[model samples]
Structure formats: structure tokens, C-alpha cells
Target: MQINQTQSDGLKQAFSVTLPFADLEQKRQARLVELGRTIRLPGFRPGKVPMSLLQKRYGSAVMAEVADESVNEATRQLLSERGLRPAMQPKVDLVSAGEDKDLEFTLELEVLPEIEVPNLGEITLTRLKAEPGDEAITQGLDNLLKSRRKEIEVTEERPAAQGDAVVVDFVGRIDGVAFEGGTAQDVPVELGGAGFIPGFAEGIDGISVGETRTIKVTFPAEYGSAELAGKDAEFEITAKGLKQFETPVADDALATELGFEDLEDLRKFIKDRLQRELDSEARQNIKRQLLDALADRISFAVPPSLSESEFTQIWNRLEEEKKAGRLDDADKDKDEDTLKAEYRAIADRRVRLGLLLAEIGQKNGITVSNEELNRAIFQHSMMYGARQQEALDMFRKNPQAAEFLRGPIFEEKVVDYVLELAKVEDKPVTAEELAAAVAADAEG
Candidate 1:
């Protein structure tokens, strides 16, 4: 057996591995002997099959297995001996496959770049802090009440207007042909709510109960359904009932209704919720700033394959958003080449940041604990409500999904570690100002 370096370049190495035919034959014989002890033939008992007969029955299959094992072992030995880590799976190509000749293959792979985590003490960050203001608390209370608001049918005979809710039966047809998902009965639509098609809610503005009207709207050119894109449709709508929302005042009674002891309790809950949201946003902003700072300070060549993989993921998401007509305003005016170029840069930055964070975490012995993982998974499962158990089961059952959670958890832990070491000065800012700062950071 021999391993020879064929080529060496930045982060990339190529090698030629050769195993003499005799060695391969020996390995094959050893594997066959290992399998023979348990072998059972039609006319022979277990461990009684003749070598010649076994060779005739399974020689080719055993040789294939031996070849794979040999290649894998050679590759593992090469990587281990060099103290190198591949950025991705190494590519192997068979150079010679004849049984009578030496077995040879070419191994090519990119190694991870060496990274030096910057001095934590040298990094200074300003962490934003905001308390939910009185107005925000009042607004939150109002929103909470509105979420529980009941609707009562209107007694007055009046035309449906903005903020008025109405139940209607409607059928939409494009070019005189009904389309799928174009009809609904007793569907509640709020006039001028902008929940339906562009002109749908406006068309209902003057409608009264028992009135019938035809509303026309054109599907956007970038609508999710290609078949309906840019097509004009007429909806024949019949108003069935009209109602108005009745929100209760945030008083003790309302608090009791919400299972809270008093209005003060509800206020405290709202304040706490708002504080959590603010803190989360602040943490996110700080993390983003830290990432940007690290990117500016660190310089290393990321594996092209890793960058390409990251770019593919970003591109896939962009394409999905574009298909759904939810492409961001920033991307709307950019040509394909421009968008690709910009996103590629983003991908490269992500790779660099990810690699740096991973290195820091490894050096500091940071890891995601099982308890933390379980807590994170539980929090994630909460998003599914009634199917939370199923969501939890999915993460527990799939290692990859668990790793997704683990990665973020590990990264956050490392970030927290870095924060503890760095000088993070809390700068108080109004909620508006903090929000604007975050927005500006996002834009830049």
C-alpha cells in the first residue's frame, strides 16, 4: 500500500493511493473467511461451506466490499496522518479497477483554514437597552383586549364601511371560467382591511346586507400561482351579514376574564412580554454587530465548496420568496447577476463568521447541553400549539433537526462567552431609537 501527494494548493490537496493486487486479494480472503463462519448453503450447514464454492457464489460481492473498505481505510489514514480536516466530503476517483492490477484512486479535498479568534478584550460593543414605555404598555393591553374582542351583528341598516366586518358568499371567475380556491361561503371579510385581493375590500365598502355586487381584481404578475398571474377576475359577491368588533375596556373584569388576578397582573404580564421582546431584539442587534465586527477583523480563505453550498441555500430561499411574490424591496430592482453577486458576498461572510464562531467555541470548550437542547426544542415546539408533541417528536427522532437547534444554541453560547469577556456597555435608548438603530444595521 502506498499514498503519494499528487498536488498541493491553498486549502486543497490531491493524492494517489495504490494497493497492490496481492494486498487486495488478502483483504478479500479475510472478509470472506469472516463471513464464512456464519454462512449457510442450500446443502451445507453453517460454517461448513467449502471455500471454492463460497468463492464461486460470493467472490465478486466480497471483492466489491473489500475494495470499498480499502478505499475508506486509505482515505481515513491519509487524513488522520496529516492532521488535516476536510471542509467537506473528500472526492475519490478510481484510477484502476482491474483485479489483476494494483488498485489505485485519486483523493481530492479542501481543508479547513486555520483561524485565530480575535482578542475578546479588544472588542468593544454598545448594547442597546429599552424599557417598554407607558404608551407601549397601554397599546399592548389594547391589543390583548382586541384579540379577545367579540363581534355583534349591526342593528342599523347601513352600508358596510372600513373597519366593518361582513360575512359574504362569493365566487370568482377568470375569463368566464371558475378557478380553484375562487369561491367561499359565509366568509368574513373586514371592509378596507386589505386581507383579500387588491380591490376586493374596497369593492365591499358600499355593500349592505342582502346586496349583490361584482368586484373585479387583477392578480399580480408575481402571484404564487403561475396560471393566475396578471389575470383579471370578477367575483360575484352577496353580502350575508354585517357586524362590528366590540372590545372590552382593560379593567379588573377583563383581567379576570383573561385568568389574571387583577388589571395590575395583566399589566405586569404585558410589561414582561414587551421586555422580553425588547431584550430579544437587543440581543439580536448586538449579535449582528458582533458578527460585522468579527468579519471586519478576521481574514481567511473559506472553502469554496462551503461558500457554494451556502450560496445555494440562499439562492433557493430567494427563488422561493420570488415565487411567492414576497421578494424584499432591496432585491426588487437588482438584476440576476447583481443579486447573485450580492448574495454570494453574503454567503462568503456567513461562511467566514460561522467558521470563526465554531473555532472560538471549540477553543473555549463550549457545547450545547442536553438540557439546553431540550429547552430549545420545547420552545420551538410551542410554535405548533396542538401539534407540539409531534414537533418535539420530530426533533428527537431526526438527528439533523436536533443539530439545527444545537448549532444555534452552541453559537449563542459562544457569543455569550465572548460578550462576557468583551466590554459591552449598555446604552439606554428609547424604543423608537433602538428600533431605528436595528433597522439601520439591517440596511447596512
Candidate 2:
């Protein structure tokens, strides 16, 4: 066996491996001998197959099997002996393979780049902190109370207005022809809610009980119904009743109605929930900042193959979004080449950051435990609802599917490990300011 490095480039290499035919024949003969002991043939006793007969019958198959084993073994040894970690599966091209000729193949692959993680202790990050304000708490309580609101018939004779729920019966017609699902009876619509066709709810305003009006509306171009999309329709609506939200006062009774011990308990729960949300957001923001800073500091060549794979995934998703008409506004105007360039850069950054995080985790001996992975898988399975057991079964059966969950868990653990070591200073800000910062980061 011999290995020659034919090409050496940054994060990529090509190797020529040669294995003598004698080695291949030796392995094939050994395997065939082992098989002969368990052989069963018609008109012949078990373990009694002649060597000549066996070789004639299965010689080619055994040689092929042996050739595959030789290639895999040679590649494994080549990578291990040279300390080369491939970023992706190596491509092997068989140059020559015959009964008498030496088995020769070329192996080409992109190797994992050498990554130098930034010093965790020296990394500085600002952790944005926000506490729920009294106004926010009051508003949250108001919303909670409103969610429990009920409607009652309007006793005063007044026109329907915004925030009022009106019950109406209506028939819709397009081109003087009625369509399916265009009519309903005693439907309750909140004025100004915009839940129905454009101008339908607003047109209901200024109408009194028992008054009938014909409202015209044009469906949106992207409306779900293909037949009615961008088409004009008229609804003959009769206002049957008007109702307003009657919210309960925030009191002990209100809390009891929501299964809480008291109003203060409800407030505490809301505050805690809000605080958790703020804390989660702050941690996420800080993580992103840390990753961006880390990326900026590192100057290493990323494997083009890895970047290409990542770019392919991004481009595929973008194409899917375009097909679904959910493409981002900023991406919609860009030509394919421009979008590819932008996404390729993004892919490069992601690969570099991923490599850095992996290095950090490796250097610190950080790992995602089986229990943690199980928890992650269980959480992911919950998204399947009634088919959660089926999801679990799939994950258990498929190692690759389980790996999808492991990647994020490992990355998050690495992030948390860095955060623990990094110098993160808390900076208090208003909830609105924090939200603005997060939004800005997302847009940027």
C-alpha cells in the first residue's frame, strides 16, 4: 500500500492511493475460505464446497467486495495518518482495478479548516436587560381581562362603531353570480378588525340595527380563493345587533375566574412570564453579537465545498419561499446572481462561525449529553401533536434525523459555554428600546 499527495491546497487535497493486487487476492481468498465453512449446496454436504468450485462461482463478487474494503481502508488510513479531517465525504475515482494490476484510485476532498477560537475571557459583550414596567403590566392585565370579555345587546340606539361587534347576515355576489362560501347568517364581525374582505368590516360601521346596506369590496390579488381574487364583489348586509366588550374589573374574583389564587398572583405570573421572555431575547441577542464579533476577528479560508453546500440549502429555501409567494421584500427585487452572491457570503460566514464554535466546544471538551439530546428530540416531537409517537419512532430509527436535533443542541451548548466565560456586562434598557435593538439587529 502506498499513498501519494497529488495536490495540496488550502482546505483541500487530492491523494493517489495504490494497493497491490496481491493484497486484494489475499483478502478475497480469506473471505472465501470463511464462507466455505458455512456453505450449503444441492447434492453436496454442508461445508464441503470445493475451493475451485467456490472461486469459479463467487470469485468476481468476492474480488469486488474486497476492492471496496481496500479503498475504504486505504482512505481511512490516509486521512488518519495525515491528520486530515474532511469537511465532506471524499470523492474516489478508480484509476485502475484488474486481477493482475495494482488497484489505484484518486481521493479528493475539502478538509476542515484549522480554526483558532477567540479568547473567551477577553471577549466583551453587552447583555441588554429589560424589566416589565407598571404600564406594561397594567396593559397586560387589561388584555387578559378583555380576552375574557363577553358581548351584550346594545341598549342605547346608536350607530355601530369601531371596536363594536356586529351580528349580520350577508350574501356576496361576483358578476351577478353567487359563489360558494360567499354568504353567512348571523356572523359576528368586529368593526375595524379587518378579518373579512377589505372594506367589508369598515363598511358595516355607521349602520343601525335592522338597517340594510350593500358594501362593495375587491379581494386582494393574493387572496386564497383563486376565483374571487382581485375581483369586485357586493355584499348585501343587514345589521342584526351591536355588542361591545364588557371587561371584568381586575380583582380577586377575576383571578379566581382564571384559576389563579388572587389578582396579585396573576400579576406575578404575568411579570414572571414577561421577564422570562425578556431574558430569553437578551440572551439570544448577546449570542448573535458574540458570534458576529468572533467571525470578524477570524481570518481563515473556509472550504468552498462547505460554503457551496450551505449556499445550495439557502438558495433552495429561497426558491421555495419565492414559489410560495413568501419571499422577503428585500430579496424580491434582487436578480439571481445578486441573491446568490449575497447568500454565498452568508453561507461562508455561517460555515466559519460553525467551525469556530465546534473548535471551542472541542477545546473545552463540551458535549451534548444523550439525555439532553433526548429532551431536544422529545420537544421536537411535540410539534407533531397527535403523531408525536410516530415522530419519536422515526427519530429513534433514523440516525440522521436525530443528528438534525443534535447540531443545534451542540451549538447552543457551545454558545452557553462561551457566555459563561465571556465578559458580558448587563445594560438596562426599556422594553421598547430592547425590542427596537432586536428588530434592528434582525434587519441588519
Candidate 3:
């Protein structure tokens, strides 16, 4: 057996491997012997077949199997001896293989670049700290009250105004033909609320009981229903009843109605919930800043294979978004070349950062525990609600599917380890200010 370096480029290496026919014949003979032990013939007992007959019948087939095994073994030996970590699977090209000839193949692979882990202490980051303000709590409470608000019937005949709920029978038609899910009776619609088409709710404003009108609306270009998207339709509406939401009073009565003990208790819950949200936002902002800082501090060539793979995934998603008419406004004006260039840079950065974090985690012995993985699986399954058990079973049965959860947990563990060593200064800001900072970070 012999190995020769064929090519060397940045993070890419190619090699030529040759195995002597003697080694190939030895492996083939061993495989034949193993098969002979279980062999059965019409006139011969098991393990009694002649060597020449076995060789004559299965020689070529066994040699082919031996050739495959030799390629894999040679590739592994090459990587192991060279101390090379491939970014992706090594490509093997069988150059030569035949009877009584030396086996030869070329191995091409992009190796993982050597990453230098930066000093976490030297990397400084400002972690935005935001606490929910009184105003925010008040707003949250108001939202909760609105969510729980009840409607009261208006006995007297009156026109439905904005914020008023109206009961109506309606049939929506596109091209003079009523569509599926287009007709309904006595549906309560809030005149100024969302959920209806762009102009459907507003068109109901000032509609009086017993009045009938045709409201025209165009579905959004990105509407969920592809058949109805961006199409104009007319709804024939007949107003039947008028109703108004009861004015909400944030008192003990309201709290009790919400299944809380009192107004103070409700306020405490809101405050706690708001604080949790703010904490989450802060954590995300800090992590993003940390990642950005690390990216700026480190510079290394990423394996082209990894970068290209990442770019392909990003480009595919961008294409899907463009097709769905949901492309980002900022990206809408960019040409194909410009978009590709920009996203390719993003892909390169992502790959580089991923490699850096992995190196750091490896050096620091950071790992995700089985318990943490199980907890993550449980949390994921909970998203399925009633099918949580089924989700759990699927994840348990599919190791590959569950393995997807490992990356995030490992990355988070690495980030947390870095955060512990890094100099993160807490900068207190309002929730709005923190949000603005995060948005600015994202845009930048």
C-alpha cells in the first residue's frame, strides 16, 4: 500500500492511493473462506466445497466487494495518517482496478481549516439590560383586558361604528361565483378589528341593521390561500344586529374574572411575564453581540465546501421567499448578482463562526448532556399540543431527527461558556431602546 499527495490548496487536499494486488488477493481469499464456512451445494455438505470451485463461482464478486472495502480502508488510513479532518465526505475516484493489478484511486476532500480560538476575556461586549417599565406593564394589562373583553348586545337600532361588533350574513364571490368558505350566517365581525380582508372590516363601518351592501376587497398578495391571493372579491353583506364590547375596568372583579386572586396578583403576573420576555430579549441581544464580536476578532479561511453548502441553503430559502412574494423589503431592490454576493458573504461568516465556536467548545470540553437533550426533546414535543406523545415517539424512534436538536444545545452551551469568560458589561436600557438596539444590530 502507498499514498502520494496529488494536490494541495487552501483547506483542500487531494491524494493518490495505491494498494498492491497481493493485499487485494489476501482480502478476497479471507472473504471467500468466511463464505465457504456457510456454503451448501447440491452434492457437497456445508464447508466441504472445493476451494477452486468457490473461487471460480464467487471470485469476481468477492473481488468487487474487496475493492470497495479497500477504498474505504485506504481513505480512512490516509485521513488518519495525515491527521486531516474532512469538511464533508471525501470523494473517491477509482483510477484502476482489475485482475492481478494494483488497486488505485484518487481521494479529494476539503479539510477543515485550523481555527484559532480567541481569548474570550479579551472579547468585550455590552449586554443590553432592559426591565419592563410601569407603562409597559400597564399596556400589557390593557392587552390582557382587551383579550378577555365581552360583547354586549345593542337593543336599539343603530349603525355599527368602528370598534363595534356587527352580526351579518355574507357571501363572498370572485368573478360572480361564490367560493369555498365564502358564505356564512350571523358571523360576528368587529368593524375595526383584524382577521378580515383588508377592506372587509372597515367597509362594515357605519352599516345599519337591516341594511345590505356589497363590500369589495382584495386579498393580500401573500395570503395563505394561493387560489384567492391577490384576487379582488365582493362580499354581499346583510347587517342583522349591533353589539359593543363592555368597557373593561382593571379592578379586582376583572382579575377574578381572569381567574386571578386580585388586581395586585394580576399585575404581579403581568410584571413577571414582561420581565421574562425582556430577559429573553436581553439574552438574545447579548448573544448576538458576542457572536458579532467574536466574528470580528477571528479571521480564518473556512472550508469552501461548508461555505458553499451554507450558501446553497440560504439561496434556496431566498428563492422560496421571492417566489412567495415575501422577500425582505431591503432585498427587493437588489439584483441577482448583488443578492448572491451579499448572501454568500453571510454564508461564509456563518460557517466561519460555526467552526470557531466548535473549536472553542472542543478546547473547553463543553458538551450537551443527555438530560439536556431529553429536556429539549420534551420542550419540542410540547409544541405539538395533543400530539406531543406522537412527536416524542417519532423523535425517539428517529435518531437522526433527534440529533438535529444536539447542534443548538451544543452551540448554546458553547456560547454560555464564552459568556462566562468574556467581559460582558450590562447596559440598562428601556425595553423600546433595547429593541431598537437589537434591530440596529440585525440591520448592521
- The per-candidate count of clashes, in order, stands at 0, 0, 0
- Listed per candidate, the RMSD to the true structure in angstroms reads 3.4, 3.6, 3.4
Query: On a 0 to 100 scale, what is the lDDT of residue 37 in model 3?
Result: 92
TM-score to true structure, per model: 0.87, 0.86, 0.87
Cα lDDT tens digits for candidate 1, 12-41: 999999988899899889888878899877
Ranked by lDDT, the better of candidates 1 and 2 is 1
| Clash pairs for candidate 3 | none
Among these predicted structures, which one has the highest TM-score? Answer: 3
What is the Cα-based lDDT of residue 250 in candidate 2? Answer: 94
Better of 1 and 3 by lDDT: 3
- Candidate 3, 54-167: lDDT as tens digits: 999999999999999889988898899889999999999999999999999999999998887887899888888888888989999988878878889899877888889999
In angstroms, the error of model 2 at 58 is 2.1
The parts of candidate 1 lying over 4 Å away from their true place are 42-50, 98-100, 159-163, 169-185, 191-207, 212-238
Residue-wise lDDT of candidate 2 within 1-444, one digit each (tens)?
A: 988889998788999999999999999999999989988978778789998989999998999999998999999999998999999999999999987889999999999988877677888999999999988888889878778888888989999988899999999999888889998999999987757878999898889999999989998866766567689999999999889877789999988888899999999989988899888888778988998888888988999988999999999998877776667768879998999999999999999999888988898899989999999999999999999999999999997899888899999999999889889899999999888888878887
* Residue pairs with clashing backbones, model 1: none
lDDT of 1 at 294: 88
Query: Which ranges of candidate 2 are over 4 A from the true structure?
Result: 150-161, 167-187, 192-200, 208-249, 320-334
Question: For this target, which candidate reaches the highest lDDT against the unseen true structure?
Answer: 3
Ranking by TM-score: 3, 1, 2
